[model samples]
Target: MAHKFPRISFFQRWSILFKCIFHYGMIFWYG
Candidate 1:
């Protein structure tokens, strides 16, 4: 259980970064 926690947190951080980058890319492309 302890080992699983860091993996989940890492995925969450990666997903957040991906989303933020994608969001800004879209705005920069279309805005």
Candidate 2:
């Protein structure tokens, strides 16, 4: 299935995961 997508798709998913982690970190710090 991974072979179906291009490298950019993988990078996009990685970026989204990073953003999600960052968002949770912000909430933990400021909540």
Give RMSD to native, each candidate: 2.2, 2.2
Off by over 4 Å in 2: 1-5
Candidate 2 residue pairs in clash (backbone atoms < 3 Å)? none
lDDT of 2 by residue, 1-31 (tens): 7688779798999999999999999999999
- List model 1 lDDT by residue over 1-31, tens digit each: 7576998988989999999999999999999
Best-matching candidate per TM-score: 1
Question: How many residue pairs clash in model 1?
Answer: 0
TM-score of model 1 (CA atoms): 0.81
